[model samples]
Target: MTNKKMRVVTCPLTPNQLHDAQLDLPKNAKAQAKLLAYFETTEEDFVPLKQLREELGVSGQAIQKLVDNGMLQFAEKKVNRDPYAGREFERTEPLALSKEQQAANDEILLAAKEGRPETFLLHGVTGSGKTEIYLQSIAEVLQKGKEAIVLVPEISLTPQMVERFKSRFGDAVAVLHSALSHGEKYDEWRKIERKEAQVVVGARSAIFAPFENLGLIIIDEEHEATYKQEDNPRYHARDVAIWRAKRHHCPVVLGSATPSLESYARATKNVYKLLELKARINQQEMPEVHIIDMREELRSENRTEFSRTLLEKIKERLERNEQTVLLLNKRGYASFVMCRDCGYVVECPNCDISLTYHQATRKMKCHYCGHEERVPEKCPSCESEHIRYFGTGTQKVEESLAKLIPEARVIRMDVDTTRQKGAHEKLLTRFQNGEADILLGTQMIAKGLDFPNITLVGVLNADTMLFLPDFRSAERTFQLLTQVSGRAGRHVLPGEVVVQSYSPEHYSIEYAKMHDYHGFYKHEMLMRHKGAYPPFYFLTLINVSHEEERKVIQTIQDMASFLRTKLGPDSIILGPVPSTISRIKNKYRYQCMIKYKKEPTLKNELKSLLEHYQKEQAKGLTISIDVEPYVLM
Candidate 1:
C-alpha cells in the first residue's frame, strides 16, 4: 500500500448501530449472504466499500448489508507499502566496477544513450558485480528521463533487489509482484501508470509495466524457468522484454551466472552482444566446493540425510558464530510416506502423485493438489502398523540439525513456514540482522541473498534434480549447485560449500565443484546437439487432458497425427504418451512433442489445432500447447 489515506468503510456496523433505525441496512437475503462471506474472509481492518464491491463483484446493497449488520464498520484506510515502510535508505552509491563490469556497463550505457534497441547477454560469474553494472546502467536510463523495468525470477529475491534499487533511486522505484496484496499492487501499478515511478522492479509480470518510454529492460537471473508463465498467455518474460525493448527502442540486458544454452548459443553466433564479468568483486576467491559422495558416507555409517562433512561444516559455522545456509530444495517433514510391510505408498486420490508427510500437522499432503489427510497409525491398505515416512525434506533436515547441534540457532524457511504474507522478508531480515545462526530453506534462498557473514553453504541433496528425466536436468543441477554455492563468501570472509551427492562423479556435480561453467556448457552442448534438444531444434509440447483416459489418449493421438501431416515429415512427432504424472486433479493427461527446425506455418497450424478443440473443451477436455517448454514432463 503506497496511497496516503482514504475513508474506507469496510468494517461491519455494531449491533447497537444496527439497532439504531437511522442506520440504513440491506433487507435482501442475498445481500446478507454476500456480506457474511465477505466478513468470513480475513481482510485488513478497513477497505473502501466502492473498492470492495468492484473487487468482489458485489452489489452496493450487498456491501450495505454487512455494514447494516454487526459485521463491518467504517474506518480510515492508510496505505502501507511494506511492513517496514517509510524507513530511510542508507543513501548508498554504486561501487566502482572491475574492468569487465565497467566494459559491460559502458556498452549498456552507450546503448541507452544512443537510444538503440540492442539485446546484450550479461554473462557474468556469480558475485561478479553484475548488479553494480545494472545500477549504473539504470542510472544512465534515469538521467535520460526514461523509465526502466527490472525483472527477477522469484518474489523471494524482490525484497533484497528492491532494497538495493530503492536505496539508489529512492521513491522513484515501484515494486509489483503476486506477493503484494491487491491494494498494494494497485498502488504500485498506479505509480507506474501515472509516471511517478521511474523504475519498476518485480518478478516476471513486471515486464508488462505500462511505461511509455522504457529506456532499459533488465532480466536478472534470466535463465530461470520461472520466467515462463505456465498458464494462459504463457509468455516468457525474457522474450517479452526483448519484444518490448524493440518497440520502445531500448536495450534488454539478460544477466545470469549461467545463461541458458539457447541464449549462449545465440551469443556465440553474434546474434546477441556478449559481455562477461569474469572475476568476483574485489577478486575474492570462489568458495571451495567439496562434493562428498553420499554412497561412501552411507557405507561408513547409515546416516542417510546428512553426510559427515556437511554436519561438521554446519557445526563449525555455529561454533565460529558465522552464518550458514543449508539448502534442502524440498519441503515438508518427509518427501513421501509409505507402508514398510506392504510397500504401499500413500498417494493423493485426485492426482498421480504421492502424499508428502508433514510432521508438524501429522498430515499427508499432495504437493500438486492441496489434498491433505491425517497420517494413519496403521496402513489403510495392509492393516499393518508399519506406516513410515521416507526421504529428507527441509523440515526433517531442520529437525535433525537442531537435535544434532543443540547450541545452533537455526531458522527454517520453506513453503509451509512462508505461506503467510511478509514471511519471506521477515525470515530473511531476521537472518540478515544476525539473529539466526543458520538459514535453511528451498530454492528461495539459493540466489540473490547477500549476507556477508554467511561463510558456510551446505547442499543436502545435490543429486535430487540430477535424476529428473529432462534434457535440461544436468544443466539445471549444475546451475543450482553453482548458484547456491555462490551464496557463500559473498563478502570479505572466505567461504566453503559442502555438497552431498550420491552421483558424485556426474559431470554436473564435478563441474560445479570445480566452479567451471565453460567446461560444463561445452559438455552439455555436446549432449544437446546429439539429443536434438534446444538450440539445435525447436520443441513444442502439446498436452491433452480430460477426465476420461480414453478421451485424453484419443485427443493427443489425433493431434499428433494432424501435426505430423501438417508440419510434414521433416519434423519429428513423438508420443501421445501419458505424461509422467498422467493424472492430476482427476484429469488424465497425454502429451505429444514436435521437434522441428523451421516450419513457416507452424505457429498458425498449432493455433488452429487448439481452436479445433475449443468446442470439446467444454466437455472437460483441456488442450495446452507449450512452445520451447522448460520441461517436457
Candidate 2:
C-alpha cells in the first residue's frame, strides 16, 4: 500500500481521481478498469502479457513497445503453455519417402531458407509423393521455429490422412475442422494462438488457425471448389492461404494434379512458381482412358443401365482378382418416375424439380427438399397404369452390377449409404480388404483413394455436369474426370478408365481423356471471357428464401433495386427471379446476382445490405448471402 500510494502520487493523475472517473462509468467498464488497476498493484496475481494483449485488443509489437518505453512490466516469469491443450491427435512415425519425395523436400527447404516467399504449384500426380513433400516442408518450417498450416478439402477427413499427420508431427500438430466438437475446436484454436502447436491441419477453416509465427501454408487439392465456402465470409481457403502467407512473408505450396484455372493462370503469368511432378512416385503411368459413347449404345439398344463395354471391363477386372470402381453422379434408384401416357413426371410439390425414386425406401423423394411419397400404383395425373422410371442413379447402377456380376460382392457409397459417421471409412475398408469386388459410388469414391488393385474405373454419364449452366462447369468436369482417373494405376499394373458419355467429343470430356489441363483451361477461359465470369469479374449472389413465394421475389427485387441505385455504372445486377430449382426444403427461393469489375469494396457493400435486410425483412422469411457462389442451382 505504501508503494502503491507513492507510485500513485508520482503519476500524472492520483488514484482517487482515477477512481472518481471510474465511478461514473458503466458496470462492465468499471469492472475492467478495476481489474487493470488491481493487476498493476498486485504483481503476484497479474495476467500474462499474451492474455492481456488479447483482452485489450492490442498487438504483440505494441505491447512490446509499451514495455520498452517503461509503461508496462512483466508481473511474473514467462511460462510456456500447452499449445494443444485438451485436444486429441493420433501420433505416428514419419513416413519413409522415395528419391522423388526427397528431391521435392530439398527444393522446398531451399526455397524457404532463402527468405523468398515461393509460390510453388506442386503439380504432383496422385501417388507422386505430394504428401511427403508436404511433410518435408512442414519439418523445415518447424526446424526454423515457425509454424505450418495444411489445408485439405473436406473429403480428406479419412483416418488415413489424420493418422499420417499424427504419427509424423505428434503433439505439435493441431487439427481444426467442422468435425470437431465446439469445445475441442476452441481448445485447439487456443493451442495454436498460444504457440503450443507448431503445425495446424484441417479442412477449409484451418486457413484461419491463429499460428503466431506462420511460415508455410500447404493447400492440398487446391482445385476443389469446397475450399471456397458458399456462405458468409465466403473465402476460398487457397486464396486466403496465399494472402496469409504473403502477410507473414512465408512460402505457400499448392499441390494438385488438376490445379484450378486461376492458379494455373497465376503460375503462367509468373505470379506463382510452377513445380511439376509429371510422373508418379514409382514412375507409374497414367491410366488409359477409353470413351464408351452412350450415343452408340442407345442407337444399338444396348443401354440396359450398364453399357456392354463397361460390363465387359468389370468382368475382366473381377476375373483378374483386381478391384473396380464405378462412378455415377446421381444418388437415387431412378432420376424420376414419369407417366408415359399422360406425359407427367412425379415432381415434388414444394420444389420445381422431379422426385427421385429410392428403391431402398420404395418412395419418391426430392433430392433438393426432403419431400417424399410412396411409389404410386397408377399415374396420379390420368389414373393410368403407365408409369415408368427414367434415367439411372447410383442405386440403379448398384442393383444392375449385383445382378450382372452375381458372384462378385458390390458396395455402394453415396450420401444415402454413408450418412452415418464412420460409414465412409467402413465402406472403403471393406473394398480395400477385397470384401467387395466392385465399389460403386458418386464423387466421394473418385478422390483420395490409392488402390493399386483398382485396375478399372468406369465413369457413367460423364456428360452429366458438362451441360451445366455455370461457366465453370467445363472446368469442374475436367477436374473431376482427371482426379478420378488419377486414382487408378498407382502400382505395377496398368489401369484403364472407361468413360460412358453421350457427348464424347465435348471439350471437357476430350481434354479429360487426354489429361490435358492446359487445353481445358484455354478453352474454358475463352468461354469465361465471353461470359465475364470469375477471375475476370467478381460475383456476389444474394439468395432470399421465404414460405411465401411472392414475398421472397419482392424482397430480392427490392434488394436488386437498392444495389443498382447504390453501385456505380461499372457494376451490373441480374436476377430477382426464381432460382434454378425455384424451391428447396419447403422454402421458395429467389436470387439476385451482382457482377463488379475491379471493385474491392463490393463485398463490404453486400455485407451492409445483408445486415440491413436482416433487420428489415419480415420475421417469417429468411435471407442467405453467398459471395461468389459456385453453383447457381
Candidate 3:
C-alpha cells in the first residue's frame, strides 16, 4: 500500500504464443525473461487482485468473490466457442400422403395418444409405400414436440432411409449409424440430446439415441436377423425399442412385411395390437413364383446352377429389355472343394468347417474365421489329382450368367465386390440406371430394394439355408425367399421369380411361392412347438472359447454344473459340446444352452449366471452370453 497507483499491463500471451516466443531466445535469456515476466505479472504493487488472479490461472468465480469483497476490480472470463455451432443441416418439407397412408397415420396416432403400443404387420407386399406410413407417424411425433427414432437392420440401407427422412423432416432429422465419422456421430448425438433433432434414423444403435421426449419408435424390416446384436449387451433393436417405448410412456410401431415369429406370437396372444396393410399402394400384384426341382438337374448333370426354366425366363426378360436379378445365398465361387476318389473334403485349419473356393482370389477361405489358403491343384488326402469345385456360389452364378447371356451387362453385388466405401450404392445405382441388365449377388440383394425394370428374379439355390440346424432356419428361409420375390413386381408390369431347390415341396418354399405368410407361419409354428423353440420357451446360449480346446470344454462343463445347481433340475442344459464349427480364429469353442419357461426372473437368473462365470473364469477362458441367439453357431 506504499504507492497504490493503478498499473497498466500489456495483453497476456496465450500458451502457444509464449511457447513460440521462448524458442527465439537464448537458454539463459529465456529462463530469466520468463521468470522476470512471471514476477512482473504477479507483483502486488504493479497488478490489482483481479489482474493477479488472471495471471495466476484462477477461475472467474474466485475473482468474482474477491471483487465482491472489494479485494478485486474486474476479471476476464474466457468463453470457448463450439466448433460445430454454425454448421448447416439439410432440411425438407414432409411429403403429402395418399388416403390409405392418412388412414394408417390416424390409426397409429390414435393408439399412440392412448399410450398403447401397436404392432403393424404392414402385410403390404414390397413397394406398398409402408415407409410412407413410418414417415407420417414421425411427422405426428414432431408436431407434438416429441422425438422419433427409426431403426433399420443394416447400415447399408441407412443412406436411402436417411435421404427419405431428410427429404421430409429436413434439419430436424439426424442420422446415427456406424458409418458416420466419430465426430459426426458425437455431433449428431449432441444435437439429439439438445432436443434440436426431432427424428433420429439409423441402424440398430439408433434405438439408444438420447431424445428428450421420445414419442414413437419404428423398427423397419423388423424380422431381419441383423436386428440382433451378436456381441456384448446382446440386445435386439426391436426388443430395445419396445423397452424404450415403455420407459418413455410412448408407442412403438414395428413395420415389417415378414414379422418375426416372436412378434407374431405376441400379437396373436393379445400382448401386442396387430395391424395389417394387406394391399399394395399402386394395386400391383405380388410376383408369381415357380419352383424348379434340382433333382432332375442332378440326374441330368446339367452342371449349371440356374435351372432351364430360370434361364428361359431371363432370356425372355432380356428380350423384352427388362432387367433381372439372380440370387445365390452363397458368396464364394464354389461352396467347397472335394477329391472325387478319396472322399476327402478341403477343410479350414482354424475352424471345423470346410473352406469355400473363391474364384477371384483363387483361394479357399473359411467363412467363419476368415482363414485362407491357395486353392490346391491336388487333394492332400490319398494324393489324388481329382480335386474339384463341388457347389456353385454367387461368383460362379455371375460367371455362368455372363457366359450364357453375353449381350446383357451383368453386375455382381456381394461381400467381395461391395466391401469398399460407396461401392454398394455404386453397384445399386448402376443396376437402377439400366447399365446392368442383370444384377447377381448374395443375400444383400434380397432386401428393401425397389427396381421397376426387374421383371425376372432367379434363385440359384433356394435350399441352401433351409435345412440349417437351428429351428429358425425354415422361418429365415421363408423370409428370404419372400423378400427376394418381393423385389420383383414392384412396378406396373407383372414380374416372376424362379426358385431352384432340391426340396421343391418344402413348406417354406411352397408357402413363399404362394406369397402366403399366414400359411407359412402356421406350419412353422407347428414345427417350433414340436421342437420347443421360441415363443413357447426361452433359450440362452453361453459360448466359451480359448486357444486351448481342453480349457474351453472344461470351462463350459463347469458353467453347466453351476447353472444346473443354481437354476435347479427343471432347467434344461444341452451341452459342454463343441460348437457347429468347433474352432474359429484359432480358438476352440464350446457351448452350454439353457432352455426354460419365460419366468419372471429368467433374465435376472441369466444375468447372475453370466456374472458368476465372469468372476470364476481362470486365465485364457472367455465366455459370451447370447439371449435368444439368432444362430447357434
Candidate 4:
C-alpha cells in the first residue's frame, strides 16, 4: 500500500554514530562510510531521509539525534545512491580558449568527433565565457567516458551552477532541483540511476537526468523564459535538451546572451549550429549604456524614482567602493494600491491584476493570486482617504535606496528576499563579499550574476517587462535589459548602464540601449513577423478551466470548435479568449490559440485534447496544454 513515490530511510551504525565519529562527524566519515556502504549493498541501498540529511552535512536535529540514539531507522526504503567517495577530483587546467573561443571549440570539437546528434547555437556575449564554454565542454564529455547535462535557467542557478560544477567535476556533480527534498529529489534521481554522476548540474529538471552515456547537453540560459516548463509535464528544457540530444547520440549546447528569437531563427536556418562569443571575458568593455529619460525625470525633476542619469551612476558607484545592481521589473511594495479620490483601483479579488504593495509584508500581494491583504486605510471602492502607491518595486527600490542614498548598502535579490534554503546562495554570498553597497533585485538578479566588484548597473524601471500583454513582452524586455546590462564591469572595473526609460523610444528600449543583440534580433524579427509570433508561428496554448463562468465559456467554446475541425485552414484559430488573468484561484479561464506552421496532427490533437479533458474532469472542466508557450498571460 505504500509505493508513494518510493520512500526511504533506514540504517544501523550507532554507539553514538560510532563514538561521535571523529568529533560529531569530522566531515562525515565519508557519509558514514556511505552509511555502512548500505549494509553491504542491495535492497538497492536505502537512502531517502531527505537524502541522508543532504548527504550528511547533517542536521534534521542531527538526524533526530541519530534516530534517538539507536542510529537511524524508519523506512519505506530503497536509498543508497552513493558517489562522493571522499572527494578527490583534480584535473584542472582548462581556461585558455578565446580566439573566438578557439573557433567555438573547433566547431564543438568537430561535432564531438561526428558521433551523430548535433545542435549548437551558443551565441555567447554576456561576459562571454558562457561558463567557460560550459566548463570546456563538460571537460570534453568527461574525456569520453560520456554523461553530461547542464540545463540551468534558475533554481537560482543552483548555487552558482553547483559551484562551477562542483569546482570542476569533483564527486562528478549531481544536482536536480525543485530545490531538492523529495528526499533530495530521490537522491539526485538515484545519482543518474546509479552511474553515480558524471556531471549533471541542474534546474529545468536537469532535462530528466538519468543519462545513459548522454555525452553532452548544455542549455545555460538558452534565452530563458524559465526554459519553458510552466506546469504539468510542459517540458521544453530547450525542447527537452533537443530530445535528450537525439536519444543520446550527443551534443546539444544552446547557451545564450539574449539569443532566443527562436534560437536566432534556428541559427539562421541551418537549423542550429552558430557559435559566436564576440568578446567579454578579457576583451571587456560592453557596458557604457546610458539612456535615462524617465519622461525627462517626470518632466524636469518632479522626479519619479531616480534618473538624474541614475543619480549620476549611483553617485559614481558610491565613491568607487563599486557595486550596484538595481533592476526593478516589479516585486511588490508599490505598483498598485491607488484611489486618490474615487479613481479607485486595488484589484485582485482573485486576480485580474493590481495588488502588489508588499513593503516587507505590510501586505497587499496577489502578484497573481498569492492574495494577501491588509493595507487599505480607505478606498476599498472609495471610502477615499486617497490611497496611493503606483509603480516602482523591489520594495520600492529598497525604500528608495534608504531615502535617497543615506550611504547605500542595499542587497535585495527579490522573490521577497530569497525564501529560504540557502537564500539564493546567501544573498549571492553577501553580494560577492563586498557586503553590499547596493544590489536591489527582481528578474532573479537578472541572469548569471558574476560580481567582480560590480561597478554599476542601475536599471530601475526599463519598462518593467515592457508593458506585457505578452507577445513575449518585447522578448522579455530585451532579455531583461540585456541580462541586467550584463551585470556591469564583470571584472576589471570599466562598466556603466543606467537605462531608466518611460519609453525612451522603445525599440525594446532602443535595442537594449545599443548593446543591440543583432539590433534586437532585427527589430524583434520584424515584430515577430508582423505579429504572427514565434519563429514564424508555432504556439499552441489551449487552456480552458471552469468553476462555471459559463463553464469557462462552454469549455473554451467546445475546444475552439474542436480545434477548427482538428486543425485546418493552415491553422491560426486565436481565441476562446478571456484568459490573461481571467479568474485565477477560482478557475474560470478560457484560451485556445493554435497558431501553427504545419501541425501534422498536432501531437495527436494534443493527445485528444487531454483525453477530452479526462472526461470533462468530472463535469467541472479544466485543461491546460501550452506547447511553446512562454506565457500567454
Candidate 1, lDDT over the whole model: 0.86
By TM-score rank, best first, the candidates go 1, 3, 2, 4
lDDT of 4 by residue, 470-519 (tens): 88887878888888899888789888888877788888888788877897
Under the 3 Å rule for N, CA and C atoms, how many clashes does model 4 have?
Answer: 5
Model 2: residues >4 Å from true position, as ranges? 1-107, 114-118, 170-172, 179-197, 565-570, 611-614
TM-score of 3: 0.82
* Cα distance off (Å), candidate 4, residue 140: 18
TM-score of each: 0.88, 0.79, 0.82, 0.32
Candidate 2 lDDT over 1-633, as tens digits, reads 011111111122345654554455466454345443644455444456556655566555644543454434545442323323454665555667777677667777777777667788878776787887888778878998989988878643444565567778887778776655565677777778778789888889888898768888898888888898876677778778878877887889998988987788888888888887767877778899999888899899886767898889888888999988888888989999999998999889888889999999999997766889998899988999999999898888877777777988899988899876557667887888889888888887787788768988999889888888777888888888998888778788889999989889989999899987777888888888888877777787888888888888788888888788788887788878788877877789888888887666666877787788776465867887776777787
Better of 2 and 3 by TM-score: 3
lDDT agreement with native, every candidate: 0.86, 0.78, 0.78, 0.77
Top candidate by lDDT: 1
User: Which of candidates 2 and 4 reaches a greater lDDT?
Assistant: 2
| Superposition-based RMSD of candidate 1 using all C-alpha atoms, in angstroms | 9.2
Give per-residue CA lDDT, model 1, range 380-439, as digits (tens): 898999888899888888888778887888899888999899898889999999998999
Poorest stretch of ten by lDDT in candidate 1: 17-26
